[model samples]
Target: MDNHDLKEDPRLPYRATSRMEVVDVPTIAFLAATGEGDPNTSPLYADVVEALYASSYGVRAVAIEELGRKHTVAPLEGRWWADDLRVFSARDKDAWHWQMMIAQPPWVTVDVVTAGIERARSRRDLAEGGRVTFTTVTEGLAVQTLHVGPYDAEGPTIARMHDEFMPQHGYRPRGAHHEIYLSDARRTAPERLRTILRQPVEQSEPQS
Candidate 1:
């Protein structure tokens, strides 16, 4: 083979675009703790995603599009509520798991998530097992921000969108406050981290 033939072009079939899109979606969701806040006792439900697809490795996912209606969260104190988002579950042959999720409904709250988990802890089936957890989610419309920075910095980006951008655009959060990390933090950098900050938003009033 000639030298030209020996040169293999490096290109991927799929190209990623650098842009953010707004969307509304209905989904079932799941919540997991990242050990960032208090564990087993903290009233914080931090991680949430739409449980869409599942496989041995994991599932493909996008930020939630919308947060839906509300329902009472049983097994929790003070009459908690949960949103109606779409969710799916899968268990790998090796018991490895992956979850693809939509955004949380506007009604889903941080308090509800941890409260649900604590309640699940009392359940015989959910406890005394491998990775047992309690989840709270709902379906509704959401606005997502694709941030290309360290996960730690995601808060500021979300703050800007919620505190400034969305309001400027005449939209307000209407769902559970949530986010998703597309990049592996173990090997990524603070400046090069790829994270998706998704927040459910709605117009102040019904649009005409």
Candidate 2:
């Protein structure tokens, strides 16, 4: 069976380095679920991840069997923020609010997602099954970089990106902090994990 890999697609900026770079991001669809708390220990976060992957793979199966098209399930992605954004700087993970998602190919529609959810439900019980929704996210202009290390060690890199890089480049944050998980934490060692960190941005106002 032929499989389409979105990660390798040139249209997406899945690649990044330790140095930040600006890029234009296009709109993309995803099967998403929102929750609050630390992903490391949150039961809701785990359920959301299970439901998202189940639905995503179910959609891929539908495409291959019913539509004669095949595609690989994309990596997990997330947008994170908090009621008090300072909580992030303070490393208060329990206070974090996040929308966890998996990118869906163009051919995967609402009907496909619905059918996939039903399929997943029949195969196994998914607590967040009904919560997953197909949605589009357009980040527009953004800056991104690759951080290769434990997630906990990302503070310094993120600090530089937000406090130093953006201002030096005439840009200001415009949206939630984003991350694309390229390596599975369960299987990859923390030091080797590759995560793409992105922040949507806009030109900063000129100083007086």
Candidate 3:
């Protein structure tokens, strides 16, 4: 989803949010990250995906610009996709910890998913029509949200985040907020939509 489309979406709870996370990325992944939908519905680009899995490195805390994405969203079945995906591994003096997942290296966002997926198929080439774009992200503080609900109900949670979570948690949005969608809307139940909204944050007044 692009910026304008994202803003017009009704599911979006807030303008945007950021977070604190240690993306424990392994080898870069072909289609390293995808939000287009129906992963199983699409052809598996095994070879390229495998290679990306084999060549990733240590984890790092990089800012992510997350946006909500929903296709044919019903009352309960909406999904979010982080667009304009960017990454930049760096060092930080602060201390925080969280789970990490294998991700494409921050600098190599390209149209490799279609190319790799095409190369993997034996007979059918479905082709990669939608791929999460990855690129370089500058370091800084940001804001985010921790949403819990059906994809359709995320708006209220986003409101909670924008109003209560950020302010009480000592955060102010520095840029476009990010969302770490931990659940698959296609598979997960509507009542059990699990998502992590990550926003950049720092000591508002020197952490006194």
**Top model number, TM-score:** 2
lDDT of 3 by residue, 1-208 (tens): 4222222344333233234332221222222333233322323333223322322211111112221322221121111223322211111102212112233323323433333333334333324322322333332544444466664455555555555666776654444444445566668887876666654445445464
Model 1 spans with C-alpha error above 4 angstroms: 1-20, 29-136, 206-208
Per-residue lDDT tens digits for candidate 2, residues 92-173, read 8998999999998888878888888788888989998888998999999999999999888888888888899999999998
Model 3 bad stretches (over 4 Å)? 1-102, 105-134, 138-145, 201-208
Order the numbered candidates by lDDT, best leading: 2, 1, 3
lDDT of 1 by residue, 86-203 (tens): 1101111122122223222234455544444344344423322223233544436666656787544444565566667777778876745444555555577778865555666777
lDDT of each: 0.37, 0.90, 0.36
| Number of the candidate with higher lDDT, 1 or 3 | 1
**In model 2, what are the clashing residue pairs, if there are any?**
none
Error of 2 at 151 (Å): 0.7
List clash counts for every candidate, in order. 30, 0, 19
Ten contiguous residues with the weakest lDDT in model 3: 57-66
